[model samples]
Target: MNRHLDTFADSIIAGKRLSEGEAAELSATSGTDAFALFLAASRIKEHFLGTGIDLCSIINAKSGRCPENCAFCAQSAHHATDSPVYPLVDEERIVACAKEAEAAGSHCYGIVTSGTTIRKGEELDRICRAVRRIRETTSIAPSCSLGIIDQETAVTLREAGVETYHHNLETARSFFPSICTTHDYEDDVETVRVAKRAGLTVCCGGIFGLGETAAQRIELAMTLRDLDVDSIPLNFLNPIEGTRLARADLITPLECLKTIALFRLILPEKKIAVCGGRERNLRDLQSWIFFAGASGTMIGNYLTTTGRPAEDDWQMLKDLELTAGSCRE
Candidate 1:
């Protein structure tokens, strides 16, 4: 099995795309096999993305009152939660956070909002102004997660100097109905398409541990591979109190590592970042993400949950002898 893993890594380095059966086989690795899997993933990561890690930070520009009920989300209005509720933050506040993120050594800074979609007149204009300012004042690339956006909105953001548009499919198309009923899976897929069509790089991915099966996890990865997204942000589930999955079991740290490795093997050349749930889910194994094939991670607080201090992440990178690479690199 270890030799096979090495061969798989070699094939990936030679530009072979893993088939569903091959990815499923890799997903079932355990014990010693899992260690070999991580090593293989690490080799693949180095070959494609180099040893340097990319760091990204996000500001929740707007919060709560989202109509869509993603089972893992804390900000959805469909479930009562302690998450903050606020309007789109002012342009100055948004740009300020971007500056802070850049100073913290983040390569990409995202301005995220909670809603079905961003309003066009005032809200969109404000975010566009903020993106323009971020481009002018900071070296960090600005991205936006303003919910389901159209081609017009995507182009408008790109024109304002937004480098990437983020929209997660949330889960596998087959399992999406179990997590979010108000919105169809195709809507999220379309958002990725719209962003790509409008000349924006799409950062698309899904959250795991939503009662999805291993097969379903592979399904989501294959879907993203087909979409040909520029980057994939892999989030683990951090069950929030008022959400539907509050009682959901936390996937083991090894499982989280395996998932990261699986994504790296499947999406070999793409920028795969372990975002959100890293601290809570990975626990003691938090530093193993890169070893398990992740090329980057989100360094600051998540949408509603607080991440560990950025200094801690910086120190971890130092301990690993890794440097944070620019997203544009």
Candidate 2:
């Protein structure tokens, strides 16, 4: 074991955040005891957030027919995976799903649409109305993941009572082109900036297991740090059949733990969540993600894939002796 690893772990244990160089070292570490790192990260999570899990759920309010050619996405028009192309869900349906998410112990319900941007007019109008209705009728915070958003749209959503805006960076700047040619990484950064400028909490994170080298993962984390994102949703790639990256191997649970632990060390006070693809990639060891400094999670189904049921996730929280509560439920 590297002596520096223990020293880095100790800094976190002592309630001191890691320096950039220290965070780089931890993210670059491989072949170490991942569980040991998880233990250290669990201490960090417990210190900052206690044993509470901020549970949220997401619905693909609008799906398929995305113009972007993101190689890992099942919803991209470039992929042959069967997906339904639908206009945004009606406001009534959006509100109803928020109610269901509340009943399932999720405090936040995300409205995700597959596209390059959520531009002006009617689509934005319907979304805003839905957000307003949810705020008035339920306790759930309406989080939006409607692709690239400008400053004005961000303000509009904020005024409509939308709380957080999720725009994932998806990969390191250098490695981004290999993943998606249709949109660049800087575009994603600007959207986060817009969201924050509008006084909305920015939930941003990248997916691992996209064939990125360890250094690229660290680069992505440092980028997130620079942006001062409020929430980080760490996703492991769940390679869907027919997508270009479908044959990509699953990221081991150990790798996932290491990433989460490093993220905890890097963003000591921000919300770090175990998001999409945890179930398939983490297998039976998903419980340890919380122990590895994940303070939150997307509890129900993901955008194009089925997630573990809400009851199962709730039971996992109980087993871990963690309290689960949110705006809705």
Candidate 3:
């Protein structure tokens, strides 16, 4: 099995794409075979991405009252969770957070909001101003998650010094209707295309463990490959209380690692970041993410939940003898 895994990894390194059947086979690995899979993924990662890893931090520029009904989201107005509800923060605050994230060794600083789409007038202008200020004031690259943006908005953000535009498909196309009903999966896909058309890099991905089958996870990865996104942020379900999936079973640590490895094999050359539920889902095995083929992670507080201290993440990287690398570069 290890030899088979190594051969597959070599093929991927030689520019072969993993088919859906191969990905599903990799997803079914377990026990010692799973460890072999992780090692193979690590080899692929080192080959394409090197040993250096990227660290990113995001500020919830706007919070709560999201009209979309993503089942795993606490910020959705459709769910009665206690996620923070507020308008977009002032430009000063947004720029200040970017500086803070830079000080914390983050390569990218994201300005994330909580609505279906940011308003065109005051909201868009403020975020653009903040992004310009961030570019002028900090070394870290600026990214935005304004949601379901059109080509004009994507162009505007690119002109404002925004390096990347983020919009998640949230789940597999086959399972998207079960996770979100307020919007179509195609909207998110088109947003990625629009951002890319406007000459902006796109960081797009989805959360797992939303009662999705392993095949569905592979399906999502294949879709991402077709989209040709620059970065993929893989999140595990944290199950916020009061949301539809609050009582959903937590994915096991090994399963989480397997998911990471599967994605690495499927998207061998893309920037894969383990974000959101790393602490809760991976727990003591958080350090193993790099070995499982993840090349980056979100270090600061998530959109609603607080992450572990940045010092801890830095120490983890140190312990692993990995250096922080830039995501945009």
Candidate 4:
């Protein structure tokens, strides 16, 4: 174990990316040394990103009524989860959420909607207007996760001051079909490509605990590494009641921490956030992620899932003495 840690330390110090086998081995590490792996990841994170946490908050601008069939998602029309079905919020309401996020010390505000596509129309226009309003009114960087978009729509978003576009590819190509059927994995790749072409920073990631294997998770990270994603939001599946995957119990806190550490080792310089299921799965040990090379965390409610309140997240940061990202203060 010590010899492997030495090799891992050497690889990170030399700025060399890990092989898939090495990553798989890192995922399989056990016991007290798991904490040692976390320490190594933290060292790499410090060398690159410092102690600043990329604190972000999201508002589900549009919820439910999604047309896709992602088995783990509550918003999917194929499921019967009792989530609020609402149209896109008005520009004023959206702007209000941005204000709230800013007041809470979030460096970025993400406007997320559940949909297959957000093409040019009143829906797109409203979201663009909201982004413009947020940019004009607050210092918070406005971001969107409205699903697949064309080049023209991407350009419109960039022009409206949308700084980042999030579109998670979910999992590796080999494991994607097992999670969702309404959309092909390549379509997601193209969306990120279009967003990049339109001059927007891309934030892409996936959910664990969908019963995917460790090798599959490593493959997903390799794909994100290839994309050069600016931010990776790792979500643990919450298995909300009534969703098709509700009965699935494929993840634990230790496994989730290992994944985060592995992500830090892989995407060392990118902002890696421990998002979603932190409140549920991480249980009492959530704060330890800062030591495990996690440079960011998502606060506030998630789409169709409840999150710890902003005050509790703030207190957590206070307890850890962590600061917001470089841009925040």
Q: Model-by-model lDDT, in order?
A: 0.93, 0.86, 0.93, 0.88
- Regarding lDDT, does 2 or 4 come out ahead? 4
Model 1, 1-329: lDDT tens digits are 99999999999999999999999888889989999999999999999989889999999999999999888888999989999999888999999999999999998999999998999999999999988888888899999999999889999999999999999998898998999899888889999999999999989998989999999999999999999999999999999999999999998999999999999999999999999898889999999999999999999899999999999999999999999887894
User: lDDT (0-100) at residue 56 of candidate 3?
Assistant: 96
* Least well predicted 10-residue stretch by lDDT in candidate 1: 320-329
After superposition, which runs of candidate 2 have C-alpha atoms over 4 Å from their true positions?
A: 1-6, 13-17, 28-32, 325-329
Worst 10 residues of 2 by lDDT: 1-10
Candidate 4 at 150: error in angstroms? 1.1
Encode model 4's per-residue lDDT on 15-37: one tens digit a residue.
Answer: 89888888988888999889888
Per-model TM values vs. the true structure: 0.99, 0.95, 0.99, 0.97
lDDT of 3 at 276: 92
In candidate 1, list every pair of residues with a backbone clash.
Answer: none
Between the candidate structures 1 and 4, which one is better when assessed by lDDT?
Answer: 1
Question: lDDT, candidate 1, residue 223?
Answer: 95
Models, CA RMSD each:
0.7, 2.1, 0.6, 1.4
After superposition, which runs of candidate 3 have C-alpha atoms over 4 Å from their true positions?
none
lDDT of 2 at 16: 72
